[model samples]
Target: MNNRKYIMLDGKVIDKSITETEFVKADKNYLYDSFGKRYLDLRSGLWNTSLGYSDEIYFSVSKEFSRLMNKKLAYLDIHSFDCKLYDELSTNIISFVRNNMKKCIFTNSGSENTELALKIASAIYGKKLNVLAINNSYHGSFFGGMSVSGIDIDVNGRMGKAYEKVKFIDFPDDIISEESMLTWLEINLEQYDLFFIEPVLASAGVRIVSDNFVNEVLRLCKEKNTLTVFDEVATGFYRTGKPLFADRLKYKPDIICLSKGINNGISPFGSVCVSEGVLVRLEGKPIYHYSTQNGNLLSVSSANSVIKYYLKNGSLLEEKVGKIETQVKKVMKLYPNIVYRCVGAMLAIEVEKQDIMRLNTILKDLGILTYFYNQPTNGLTILPQFNINLDVLEKALRIILNKIS
Candidate 1:
């Protein structure tokens, strides 16, 4: 057994030393542990590896980094950067998300992106910082993010007290009438300066809100002059069969937060894309947030490659996600007792709490990886890579069904 003890894996139950022994290399859609056991990565490495491991993007990024090795610099002011490569990469990102969103602010992770968005909104509406977030939505794990997140399991004791200015509303449910949801929004519209939401509640077991509900919320926000922020960390970059889930919404949000699949899981990167109106609000003000690794050359290059790849191959990737959604629906039909919700390549199945643990163990034993969500109810969340082989996915589903059914 490995004797090293200064390591930790979040949400892991095994002893630290044992978990360390499982460390190994990853290639494509599989992970090989020290014992040479290959496991199918269904969670896509925390739902970030949309393009899978060891992809060409990684190789290209390596080459680019090598070329720029001597010139690599950190903590430089964004306003004074003169690197041509950096400019090209930034331009590519802005063009990739062309439309009302003309400006991009880079961050190192989804949590930071959320925090930045909040800060921008706060700056625009100083002293009027009342924020509204949906229940069951997860923004991130950082203090500011945890304050707005509905699922407090991760930050319960550690977060101290929730932000007093932030309020939570129940996420729209199928059981709730549209009239009721609209009424609630109308009542609370004038109280908040900003509204935050995840296009798809991925961490909350892939819960999807109806478009009507979202549109109405946006309309109310517009009327109240409250800025709306979409946490697209989990639903952006064609993960939802669209470039961004916000694209499907009739009413556009003022600010959009993106990460996770932004760089096809190749680098730790996140960005907040804002509309011209929102940008103008902060044009003369100093941005209150800054990180040492924000918009690093490596991350920028990887993001450029990932965005270029997606723009070129989006149609094929959409078809692949469509097939996976179809497969999930078919599986759901076979087991009426198991409730399921799916969108694009993401799926969530609800089961008994005990069954969640049992199925997770079985899936692990079968060399498949998945995430279990215990909040809002027990659920097995599945986020497979966009290009996952159908045969392998089918086999994994079969194994799950055989064991769960």
Candidate 2:
């Protein structure tokens, strides 16, 4: 495919932009420029390119679904074989998912899953839409997700004081002390309808909640009649060393969000796994929250495949990621001034820099993708896929260390 207006116009982007080695063809896991240099994808290109490019199996499933989907939306639902595929995928996924979370509602993106979850929580629970979120969390750029998100100063106005309905909590970097959560709950947790969390806060820099603190939060929330919601958009799939972060944490959120990995089936698939209890509350409701492109045959087919691959052969990936974490710790020791975190395969290394741009420019050219010092981390992250090879990861880390040093 030709470039998306990026090639014809050279030197156009001026915002410390991300330019590929070439402006030419877009392929799976591989981007080729007019010059023909191949860049190994380190960041999964927006962190969603699992199963990599040139995944023929994924395309095959899409083609099979398209033969059935090249019709009207109405026909695509009732008369389409896609429904059976959806049922089968969802059914197969449940055994892999938590037992309390037994139902799923499909959506277009993780943000949609967040929105739908919040909406359902309020509709099913009550009009009080107050949700508690840790500071510096990244749910999404959209409003509902943004509203509950701890990302401060959202320029898009996706979040505002309009979302005062939401509450903010300090995510504990250490074991969330019972003393801390109980203290927090005493000051807050009132009229709080739901507690939303990323078991391992990724965007805030791979900070894992202390097991004791996490269990205490659940206990306190249940004691206080607060519902728990896990936003696993980034951590889902095999990214977190498990299919979902909650899987490792073993907590059944009233609503468990899924995206980014759902449709490694083809492209762009996301959804939510609603608990049986949440579903019970949502029954008999006249909520029309479905999206047309949602549950698309192509994406669902790919999502099913990704899930199968993980459930069947992802243990090896987990072992590799565990090693990557260990290696990262050893490397971080060389940079004592750098504050860092690595948990469940998500990682961040924060450096107090006088000029951040210099650091980013050096790393970007090295084929390592990362965000700037956004929030609390003041450092970016290394969020590779579960199946990402160890050598590929080590090369990136070493390159980063060399540049920083």
Residue 373 error, candidate 2, Å: 3.8
For each candidate, the alpha-carbon lDDT, in order, equals 0.78, 0.67
Query: lDDT tens digits, residues 1-405, model 2?
Result: 354544432224432234534447545444555667555555555567644564554565656566666653323442334477778778767766764788777677877887787777778665667778877777776667777777653542532643557777777655445477668786677668888887776666676666666666776776787888878787776676666666655345677888875655256777778777777777897675766677566666667766766677667767766776776777778777667777656677775663455676666665455555456746666665545566667777777766655
RMSD of model 1, in Å?
2.7
Model 2 residue 368 CA deviation (Å) reads 3.3
In model 2, where is the ten-residue run with the lowest total lDDT?
Answer: 8-17
Tens-digit per-residue lDDT, 220-286, candidate 1: 9889898999888888877788777876777889988888888866778888889999988887776
Top candidate when judged by TM-score against the true structure: 1
Question: What count of clashes does model 1 give?
Answer: 0
